[model samples]
Target: MTSIWDPIRIGRMALAHRFAMAPMTRSRAQADGAPGPLAAEYYAQRAGFGLIITEGVQPSDDGQGYLNTPGIYTEAHVAGWRRVTDAVHARGGHLFMQLMHAGRMAHPDNTPHHRQPVAPSAIAPGQTMFTAAGLQEIPEPRALSTDEVEATVRDFVHAARQAIAAGADGVEIHAANGYLIQQFFASNANRRTDRYGGPIENRMRFAIEVARAVSEAIGPERTGLRISPGSTLGGIDEGPEGPALYRRLVPALAELDLAYLHVAQGGNEALLGEIRRLWPNALLVARGGRPLERAAADVEAGLADVAPVARWALANPDFVERYRRGAPLNEADPATFYGGGAHGYTDYPTFGRALVAA
Candidate 1:
């Protein structure tokens, strides 16, 4: 049986282990959406994983949904991220900047210039988002015209380019987690009658176009995507037809031959296996709340190429070595998970270093 510490080949790079750091929003960046001084140290401390997916970063101001989340659209943002990537690479780690457009999941108070949120449709999620002024109710989003929709695709392309300029190893387009792309897939949030709405094919067209644009901008080998087929966060409901919709989307994405496909599924072994079958010849990453044992089983069974653990990676900087030695793992602090300083982000001690302190 292949262990989690086994070396694996993902994309164009050979990873030292199978464990990956799943992207989680830390909300520690500067108010201008640029990474702060501690960003590099935070990532550098957890460079043991085979790959690290950074937090959801907006591709444009319209994509800013949460307060203090980072961005890669501007030159300064690019420079800030370059420092982060440089630090991670110095530790022999690979990083991918997640290009996330929040779509309707935005509060004007959270963004610079307080721009209104936009989506495939004008409908709102009837939810609230964290802002500098506290949690504010999400306002109605403006519907994007066809031309504007195309422009959004271009925005993703530009963001991917910026990520490359920022010294990132690659880019992961965020199409999951109840964000803008997934919002279009949900029947409740998307009520448009245009090419971006209605049946699954039409709704999926926008996502495919966006991915194609990014893949074209950067080589397909350096581009990846994340998806959650049945997620209903932020007042989204794709209905009972959710699974079928993803059935089609997977093959379409596979056709592009992008770097890999990272799937976030809670359980659904059958679904994971189905996606693995459809996405043949591409690297598959399965990320959910599964335990290490289950994740290893998935990888051993060829259901996934890698298993990503978010909170585990956050709390255990030496997660790979701990897993290898069967050492006791440290519990993560929930309070400091978001919008915190270096306490929880970079303070996790490695097993060897912790033993030395002991």
Candidate 2:
């Protein structure tokens, strides 16, 4: 049985432990899309996890979906992230920058160019989001032409290169959580007749192409892909073929011999097990609505190589040490969960450190 403390190797990065600090959105980046000033401190504090996947970073200006999220396709962005990656590496932690695009789940006021959000089809997520002016309804997005779709793939490739230039150990393609790549997986959001639409193979095309391109740009050993099949977030519905889609998609992505496959499981044990079997490389699984203690269940069961934790790791920077010593964990405050400063961002104390009011 694989214990949570067991060492694991994912891609070319050898981790000292079997858990990953799950990628989370902090909503604290600069208006120009550079990472926040305390990003280095924020990430380094959680470096004990060995594998720290950073927040969802936009691959382009058009990929911004919320206020103050970070981007990775610019010199300033690379400079900002270099500080972060350097801090993590200093503490013996490997960081994988997650490349995310919001698609139609965006508001014009939230982006740099202030242009309409783009998706595979001209559909809105029917959701409201926080912008500079406050909450606003997400308007209908413009459908991407086949030519524009190809350009988006290059955007991901460029971002991957930028991540490497910034000293990241690798990059994770965010094809989950109702983002642009997940939008393409959604039947409701993606209604185009292009090669990237219609059948499951077509819907899976953009994601695979982006992965292949990113792997080509930055070696496959330095690239990983994340997917959440049957996701309903941001009003996505993968339709009835969702299960079958992963059954085929996982194996297809495996042929690229990518670093690892991170699956965001929605309590679907059967599907997750099938993905574990299909993927030949390291398999990192993130379980929703589960405690950090429960996060190791998949790893112990031989169904996952590593279990990624989100909220617990966010609240307790020294999560691994606490688990090792059986220390009481701190609870996270919902008030400072988003768009906040170091109060909740980096003030979370390690086990015996002085408690700060959140």
Q: Name the top TM-score candidate.
A: 2
Q: Estimate candidate 1's alpha-carbon lDDT, on a 0 to 1 scale.
A: 0.86
Per-residue lDDT for 1-358 in model 1, tens only?
7665668776777997777889999889897789978999988888878589999999999888888899999999998999999999999999999999999988888888787889888888889887777778999999888898899999999999999999998999999989999988888888778888999998888889988999988988899999887777878888888888889999999888988998887566677778888986544565656676575766676677787878888899888778878898888999998897888888888887788989
Off by over 4 Å in 2: 355-358
lDDT of 1 at 12: 79
Give the alpha carbon lDDT tens digit for every residue of 1-358 in model 2: 8898888888888888898899989999988899999999999999999999999999998888888999999999999999999999999899999999988888999899999999989888889998878889999999999999999999999999999999999999999999999898878888889889999999999999999999999999999999988779999998888899899899899999999999998867889888988999999988879865686888999999998989999999998888888788989898888887999999988877744433
Residue 136's lDDT in candidate 1: 80
Worst 10 residues of 1 by lDDT: 280-289
Checking candidate 2 for backbone clashes, the offending pairs are none
Local distance difference test values of all predictions, in order:
0.86, 0.91
